[model samples]
Target: MLSMLRLTVITLLLAPQLAGAESLVSSLSDEAIEITSSFTGSRIVVFGVVRDEQETLDEAEYEIAIVVQGPESEIVARRKDRIFGLWINAASQPFFKVPSYYVVHMSENFSLVASEELVAQYKLGLANLNFVRSAYSPEARGFADAVIDIRRRENLFAERPAAVAFLAPNVFRTTFFLPAIVPVGTYRVSVFLFRQEKLLAAKTENLDIAKTGLSDNIARFARAQGALYGIMTVGLALFIGWFAGVIFRRS
Candidate 1:
């Protein structure tokens, strides 16, 4: 309740600034996400407002796309082949600049209404994402398909059409879920405004997903001192084994 009130107030205060051009502005419900031991999942709400010169245009005349994207990574997709009745990796394709998580929400049915060329130009879908090493073999549904399928099944990527709901004439909002396994990194939330299927204005905001509490300290240490972490793990294992042997011998 409070968050919505705050958003509404902020939007009202910022409306005067967006009057000159086809202005687009947006905000996130939470700028930062903290991952703790008990964090199961979280929801992200994106609030936006589109302003234009025309006063009588209905909300239906505008097409809005809200995208939440996580950090970039290089992913490898491997194909398994049966060799002597054993499944093993036979071929692999590397995907560069892959987002750890990605989801797009649209105000209308963009897939049916928008042209392929326009969609590609805007990079609205997973298929339109920039790929450096693309094994785009449609017949085999190769690496691109494999990567998309895996991410979708894991709830790391999605495409939602007609998901943006209007709050007022120019005010709108969209929501997306972050799974328990959401990657910890800086994310980008982008809101795009379109009219007659043409992009007019765009806005972006940053979101940080991070570990907290004892878990955060451990993760920081592990990442900063990988060799020391490995050595400590081996030492702990040895100590545990020795202690177990001594207890068994006494028994």
Candidate 2:
């Protein structure tokens, strides 16, 4: 309750600065997602209304783009080179403040809706995402590409150019998917309104993905009592091994 109130206050405080453009209001279908053992994947619907105070936008003049971003974390990407019939890490780069998961949905192809500079400014697409490296290196770009490739293969980062659809006048929506292996953390949903390739307004919403039930308890225990948990894990492994050996011997 308090957090929601705080968010409302912050939005109100920021509204004055955004009054000249179309005002966007957006919310998620679900504010919190609970993951369980049977979890496969989840879908979230972003529903929003755009208000053009002057009523100036025409049917084909406006566009919408929505991006869902997971929590930022550090990621390291390495390059391998084969030497003497052995593969070893040759180059590495550390990326800071990279989204663990990212997906963007747009009313049309980003290139069709906005200029390359505008899209790059917003970092709306995977190729345009702002990845900060620990230090400059000649192979950093390749390492960045490797990071994106790995995440793409894992279904963590993706883009859909024409995913957002219009429901009625000044209303838009899009669906975003979270894989079963999604990291448990906070996520951000950003909505942008554009007209004739010009940015009009933007809005943001937050959602939380978390573990529940037995899984939540186990995670809490492991975090709160790491040493104890490690000891217990070792003991359990030894007992399981001995029990399996005894059963096989009897057989």
Candidate 3:
């Protein structure tokens, strides 16, 4: 009777932990996206489920964040300053390992999802992104913010709160749009699960964006034969201009 009693106590202690041992299983709508002339934009849905669900929890208590990030590149951010009442590019800063594209979809607001340290560690939002340089100065920060503002206006960087939708207690999904100007490379789709400011599970998936058909050929040819490509572009422009004039004259 004593051994059975001990076993019962241990089981009771472990029950809650076992029930809450949830992990994420997720997939992207498209693993590969091809960019063509008609490729204006695309939408990707991240479908996910919490596996090993032994217990049901309040949907309000469950937190999820999904991020889609494009390839990283080094960039120069130039800031314009008003000189004699005319704004001109005055200062420039270089940033390394900055994402070319980044977007976030959150189940809740930033403060409600997790602590500041965890959010910054996981880059759950635009403000938490770690875009930095060797010199951490106020001027550099201004440059970085300028660059981010430009990207945000262009739909390259974004954050959407309450974007994740829960179909069931353990099932959820999110969808985000990729603009027509999305860069061509391998992007990462990251899904994170949180509860009471603690991370429960995380998953990452890869997405490929590449130029297809004539677009690919033209890009490659332009890189390989720069002078020839420039001449061809000029000729095409002139031909289009003359063609338009002739049509208008006839009309």
Candidate 4:
């Protein structure tokens, strides 16, 4: 009887941990996006489910954060200041690796999801992004903020708090808008699950953005024959001008 009781106690102790051992099943609505001349924007929906067995895991205590980041590039933000009654480039800061596009969707406000340390570690918000500084300066902080501000204005960086929607006990979904001016390149969609400031499970999916139709043709032509493309462009402009004049004269 004592041995049976010991076995029962061990099973009871292990049940919760086993329940916590869940996996994430995730996928994007579209794996690849093509931008054409008439392309305005697109909507991407990320959906996933956490399952331990056939049954879905309870997610009331869990928080989800989704980040879609475009390719990284070196960026410089210049600051203009008034000197001799004229605004001039007084200071500049260079960021070594900055994402061209960054958008985040969160289950709730960051503070409610996790501690500042964990959020910064995972870059759950814009303020936590570790855009490395090429050089150090006392004014560099303001420059960094200025860069982020400009990106925000251009809709390249955005935050959508409380955007995650729960479809079922284990399934969740979040959607983000891709702006018309978004850069065409590879992007990463990363989803993180956190519980009480501790990371539980994380998944990353790749997304491709490329030009299609006339846009793709023009880009390829420009790369392959730059001089010819320029000449053709001028010729086309002249032809269009001449055609418009002929039509107006007939009218």
TM-score per candidate, in order?
A: 0.80, 0.81, 0.78, 0.80
Question: CA lDDT, every prediction?
Answer: 0.73, 0.73, 0.73, 0.72
What tens-digit string does per-residue lDDT give for candidate 2 at 1-251? 11111021011111323535566545455578777766677777776666666655566656778888999998777888897899998777778888999999998744475887788788888987778333355578777877888888888998888898777756666777777788989988788777776676788888888877686778889999999999999999999999999999999
Cα lDDT of model 4 by residue, 1-251, tens digit: 11110000000001123225654545555577877777777767777765555344454466788898999988888988899999999778778778988999888634465777887788777887777333356578778878889889988998888898767645677777777788889998888776676666777788888778897899889999999999999999999999999999999
Badly placed stretches (over 4 Å) of model 1 are: 1-21, 28-30, 52-60, 109-112, 136-141, 234-251
Residue pairs clashing in model 3 are: none
What would the TM-score be for candidate 4 when compared with the true structure? 0.80
Model 4 spans with C-alpha error above 4 angstroms: 1-19, 54-60, 109-111, 132-136, 238-251
lDDT of 4 at 112: 66
Cα lDDT for residue 202, candidate 1:
69
CA lDDT of 6 in candidate 4? 7
Kindly list the per-residue Cα lDDT of model 1 for residues 84-188, writing each as its tens digit.
Answer: 999999988777898999999988645457877777778888877776225556533567887888899999999898888877657777778887788899998
**Positional deviation of residue 146's Cα in model 4 after best superposition, in angstroms:** 0.7
Angstrom error at residue 71, model 2: 1.0
Clashes of each: 0, 0, 0, 0
